[model samples]
Every structure is written in C-alpha cells, then in structure tokens.
Target: MTAAARYAALLQWLRSNDADISPKIDLQPSSRGGGYGAFLTEDAVEGELLFTIPRKTCITLADSIEDDACGEGFKALIETAGPGGNTVVMAGFMARERIRSLESQKPGSIVDDSSFGPYLATLPWERGMNNQEHVLYWDNKDIEKYLKGSMCYGEALDLRKEVDVAIRVLNTIVGKSIREFRGDYLDSGFQWPWEKAAQASEEKLKGPPEGLAEAVKGAFVCMLTRAFEDGDGDEEKLVPMLDMLQHSDEPNISHAMRKSDGAVEVRARQDLTAGQELLNQYRSELEETMPYHRFFTRFGFVPGIQEEMTNLFEDKSSIFFAQKAEI
Candidate 1:
C-alpha cells in the first residue's frame, strides 16, 4: 500500500475509536525532511484543539504487561529489571503487535489484526524520511570515526551496548534466537511488510519467524525517539497523531494528557496559518539546557550547533585546560 493509504487508514481507525481529530489539520510530507508532519489545512486561532487521542488507544506499559501473549513474561521482566523494564516491555509489545499485524493479513487466519495495527503499519522500520534513524543504529566504526573526541562518543557506545543487552533479554521472551541483520530483511531470512512477496508458503514461514530481534530493536528505537512520558507512572505512551509532529525550537503546538480520563490532547500555541506545518518541541526549557552531547545521544540529532564554525568537544576540552591553568 502507498504511504497515503496507510495514513488514511490510521485516521479512519482513530476516528472510529473515538479520537477527536480536527478537520483543519492533516498529515502530509514534512518540509523539514523528516518523514511526515501534521499540516494545518486552514487558519486556526491559538488554543484550538488539534487532536485528542483516547486513553485506550495510547500504547502503554500497562497494555504490554496485560497482553495475553507476552504479559506474564513481560511482568517477570519488569519485576526483575525494575523501572527500566518498562521500556523493555513496551518495545516487546510493539514487536509482537507488528508481527501480529503481518499475520492478520493472511486469509482465514485465527489471529486478528491488533487494534494498534493501523498505527503500527505507519511506522518506518528502515529509516528514510522518518526521524527513525537513531544513533543506536550506528556502527562502532562509524561512532569512532565521526563521534570520537565528541562528548557523545562514549554515550553512543554505551547506548549500543545497552540495546545489545536489551535484544538478548527480548530473546528470552520471544522464544527465538533472533539475531540482528544490518543488511536487508531478505538477507536475514524474514519477509518484511515492504517485501513484495514471500519466497516460502505461509505454513513454512510460520516455522518460527525470523527478524524478531530486528523488530524488537526497531521498536526500541521508536520508544526512544517517539514515546511521551505518562504523567501517572514511570511508563511512557505512544501517542499517535501527537507524535507525528516534527520537533522544533519554536513549536506552534503544545500537548497535555488529561488526568481525568488519560486522554492526550494537542493544541495550537499560537495563531497558525493555512498550510503551516505543525511542530512540537520535544524538550522542555530545562531539558533544552542539558549538555549538547547528551541531547545528541538521546535524540540522535543536535539543535543549533553550527558545526562549520565550532567544534563543541574541542572547545569544551580547551575550557577545561584553561581552568586548570588558572589554578
């Protein structure tokens, strides 16, 4: 299916599930060059409601633990891993749901497409325009070549190791010895959704699926890059339309989850014109003040760094030397 079809399905499914989406806005290719963004189709005043995703539709850690297939295993994982396990459970849920989505496409299959399938279908597994490309996916060689001497270099290495461990943990849950294949999914022996056709029959393909690890990794990347904190708990939620907006320093939109019903709402922070691409500021004022290297390690991109004029790592080390000299 085309990207437009996938998006249309998402909106249709959302509205059917009681999400209140504004007629004035729609998802379109972002001019910012990072996949799609919500665009205002007509002029709107500040405080106008853009969208409200129902609480049930939000993908949460609770849902992961309650899931029939992996719930018990995930519960054990969380109990053992403590707070950090929340992220692991969510990523596992995403991986399971994605596989179910693919399975649901089969004729007369007992498995049904998950309610989260529509939204999951829209997610990018292989990075393209989507900001799905993250530092975690970078190789150690590249990390050393490009990030060396930068403050984030160590952070990047640590993140890579963490994900490797996470994948191993996920292996115990999925019952497959899934390995990461940096190359194409076909080379990895899995038929991804993007593949035109599977070389094997449906029955043969089900002989323990390939790429579960890759799916887990992709979901982990999504959780890191897209999820928003749920105010009630340590868990984060994958809020649908709200996450579609690209990040910016001067965002035209703001969002809050309603404490009463757990619904998430996004609104215009300023008067917006027709054709304006809605933007969201991922970090708060305090978060924005964090060290630039930490920011890059977390979000995969740094803001406001004029790389041509400054080497922040070198500059930082120079400042340290100067301070020592003064002593």
Candidate 2:
C-alpha cells in the first residue's frame, strides 16, 4: 500500500479502537524531513483538542506483559532479567506482532495476523524510511568513524552493547517459553545489522532462522525514536496519532494522559491556523535542555538544533578522528 493508504488505514484502526481523533488534525509528509507529521485541517484556539487515544490502544509494558502469544515469555524475561528488561520485552512483543503481520500477508497464511498490525505497519522502519533510522541501528564502525571521541559515541557504544546483551538473553528466554516465536517468527521480520553486513559482504549462513535478534533490534529502533512517557509515570508508551507529530524547538502542541479516562490527549499550545503543520517538543525544556549530541544519539536526528551547535561537535569529532588515526 502507498503511504496515503497506510495513513488512512491507521485512522480507521484508531477510530475502531475508540480513539478520538480531531477531524481538524491530519497526518501528512512532514516538511521536517522526518518522514511524517501531523497538520491542522482547520483553525483552532489554544488548548483545543487535537486527539485522544485510549490507553488500551497505546502500546505499553503492562500490555506487553499481558499479551496472549508472548506474555509468558515476557514474564519470564522480566523476572529473569529484572526491570531494565522491560524495554526488551516491549520491543520483542512489537517485533513479534510485526512479524505476524508480515506472515499474514503471505500467500496461504491468512491466520497469522497481529492485533496491532495496522499501527505496526505504519512505523517508520516498517515503511522503509531508512533516513529515519535511530543511532542504535547505525553500524558500530560508522558510529566510531564519525563520533569516536565524543560523549555521544561512548553512549552509543554502550547502548549497542546493551542491545546485544538483550538479544542473547531474550533469545534464550523465547526459546524456552514461546512456541509461536520459536521457528519462523524468530528468523523473519526486520533486517538487523548483521543481516545488512552479510548482504554487503555477499555471505550467507545456512542454518535455523536467526532473525529474532534482527526483529527485536528493528522494534527497538522504532521504540527509541517514537515512544514517550505516558505521564502516568516513568513507563513510556507508543501512543498512536500523537507520535506522528514532528518535533520543533517552538512546539505548537502538547500532550498529557487524561486522568479521567486514561486517554492520551493532544492539545494546541498556541492558536493554530488551518493548513499549519502541527509540531511537538519531544523533550520538555522546562524539565531539562537536551544537548545536541545526546539528542542526535537518542532520536537519530537533531531536528531544530542550531547548525553551529552541531557543526562544533562535528569539527571536534573530526579533529579527534584525525588524531586517533595518526596513532
């Protein structure tokens, strides 16, 4: 399906699941170059509601833990791996659902559908928006080449290692608990770095499908770039519709989890005009000002960051790279 079809499907899915989307707001190709963003279809005053996504429609750790297909595996993963593994479980569940969605599309496989298939289908990674890739998906060599001596580089390396560890641990857990995730589900969906490297090197390894690791990493990339705190607590969630808004230094909209109904609500921070692109502040400046390197490393791009701020780090990293090369 084309991008427009996917967006339409998403809207349909959202409404079917009790999500309240404002007809005044629409999702469209973003001018910010991040693939997609929300735009205003009608003029609105400050604090006007843009949308409200029911909490159940939001992908959260609790929902992952209770999933029918992989809940037991997730329970075991979290119990064995502790709190940090919660993120892994969420990503793994999403990956599994995504894999299921793909399988359903194959000939003679109509039963292999995911409950959250439409939302998963709209994710940037699933849409082949390579430019929207998070830093965690970048090759280790490329990360070192560009940012070796910078603080972001170290953080990136650490995050990569963490993902590697999660992959190994989750693989073992899935092998022991989840039957549905055993064979093809583990081996298909989402290309990983190793798969990319193998394709680049023209090397093919014949064996059991090892794509589970790839699937998890792919979901992690999506989670990293899109998920946000639900305002209920530190538990982050992937809220549909709200996540489609592009980031801007001066945001026009803000979101909060409604205490009354457990819905995620988006409201205009300032008066909005018809045809204006909706923008969100990914992080709160009042809480903390994110540095350029950290923002770039975390979200894969530093949208709205000053050119000089980014270039200063690039110049420093270039000097550091040259100095290390001399060694």
Candidate 3:
C-alpha cells in the first residue's frame, strides 16, 4: 500500500478501536508530509473532549502478554522480568511484532500483519523525522557536526552509554532468560537484525543478539517519544491516537488522567481555531524545555532551535552507521 493508503487504514483502525475520535479533529498526514498530525476541523474551546479511548485498548505489557499474536516468547519475558524488565519486554514485543509485519509485507499487500500493525504504521520509522535526533541513534559524525557544543550534546553522550548498558543487560541478563524460556524464538528466522550488523566488529563473539541492542533502542525510542504513565505511579504505556500528536513547545491541549475511565484524556487548553494543528506539550519549563540537540537526537526535529546548530548536519551524512557505539 502507498503511504496514503496506510494512513487511511490506520484511521479506519482508530475509528473501530471502541473510542470516539472527535469529528472536530481530523487525523491526516502532517503539513510537513512526514508523519500524521491531528488538525482541528471546527473551533474548540477549553475543557472540550477531543477523544476518549478505553483503558483496555491502550497497549501495555498486560495487553501484549495476553495477545497470542505476540507469541509465547514475549509472554516469557514478562513472566521472568517482573518489574525490572518492563522496558525490555515492551521493546522485544514491538520489535518482534514489527519484524513480523516487515517480513509479511508483499509487493502489493494492502494489509499489515502484526496485531498492532495499524497503530505502528502511524509512528515515524525512518531515522531523520523522529528516531535520528536522539543520541542513541546518532552517527558519530553527526554527533560532532550537529550536536557538539549544544546543551544536549552531553545527554546524547549519556543516552548512547545507556543504550550500551541496556544492550549489555538485555544480552547478559534478559537474553539468558529468553534463550532458556523459549529458545525457538531466538532461532535464525526470528532473531533480531543486530547480530548480522554487528559481525563487522570485534564484538561478534560477545554472544549477544546484536538485534537486542537495536531492540533496546526501539524500546527506548518508544518510551522517549510516546510512553506516559497510566496514572498508576510510574507505569508507562503507549496510547494510540494520543501518541501521534506532534510535539510543540507551546501546546494547545490539556492532558489529564480521567478519573472515571482511567484513560489519559486531553482537553482543549484554550480556544482553537479551525485548521490549526493540535499540538501536545511534550516538554516545557526552563530545565525541561527540549534543547535542539536532544530534540534532534530524540524526536528528529527541534521546532524553533537556532539555525547555526542545525547547519552542522548539512555537511555530513545523516545516516548513522551502528557500531558498538560508545561516547
């Protein structure tokens, strides 16, 4: 299917998800023509409900484990990891399921195969738009060229280190459980893509599925860009339409936990005129306001970052070649 067709399918899926996406807002390809965006079709006032998704439909570890399409491998991870591995479990579930979707794609197949494929399609998959900005996904040259001397440069360095440790923990600790739990899941056909990519380096004998490292990145990316607490303290979950909203330094939506249904509900923060893009407050405050380097490293764009900083990326290849990346 074309990108337009896929977007339509995702909208169709969202409409059928036992929730009400307000007709006042329409989901369409963003004006930038990269990922989808939510736009207002009619004027909306503060406290108006834009949509209300059921708590059950939200993707969580419990949902992943309950679904058979996720396979027994992911369920095993959940049973073994307990609270310590929620991030890994979510990552593995998404990665394996995503690979299944990719492998299942045909020359003209109009459908996505994974259980959550429709929702997944709404997210940005390529490097630049969202994933490339974060330090975890940065190429070495881009780091020096675009990120160095910025406030986020150090964070990019730190997150790169975190990915390294997460990969190590996934391989040494989680991989052991995965291997022992459902050894078949790690077989050649189902194994992640990292090992093949990692073979060029001296780390081949390290016994980690090079894919696990990438999975950690995938999980972290999902967490960084989307996950919100389910109002049960720090339990983060990925909500469908809510995750698709573009980030804005100055937001127009008010987010709150719905007491009645347990859904993270959003209301119009102020009066919104028709045809405006619905912006979600991602990070604000002097300390929390996302710096350009961190924005590039995490979400792929920096909204209103300085022109001098982004100019550095023009001279270098934006594609990051993954190695055992260390700062």
lDDT of 3: 0.63
Clashes of 1: 1
- Clashing residue pairs found in predicted model 1: 35-129
lDDT of 3 by residue, 143-206 (tens): 7776565555677788777667666644543444333333333434543567645532323345
Error at 215, model 3, angstroms: 4.6
Q: For candidate 2, lDDT tens digit of each residue in 51-122? A: 889988888898888876568878988888788888899887776677667777877764557778888878
Segments in model 3 whose C-alpha atoms lie over 4 Å from true places: 31-34, 64-84, 107-112, 129-132, 148-150, 168-215, 230-234, 288-300, 306-309, 312-327
1-327, model 1: which lDDT tens digit per residue? 788888899999999999999999788887875578889899999999989999888899889888775688899998999988888888888887777677678677666677799999887665443655466666667666656766666767777788778766765665331221211223445557756244323323444346666677778777877899856563688988888787787999888888888899999999999999999987753564555556566765556542421244445543112234554
Q: lDDT of model 3 at residue 249?
A: 66
For each candidate, the alpha-carbon lDDT, in order, equals: 0.73, 0.72, 0.63
**Residue 75 displacement (Å), model 1:** 1.0
**Candidate 2 lDDT for residue 2:** 80
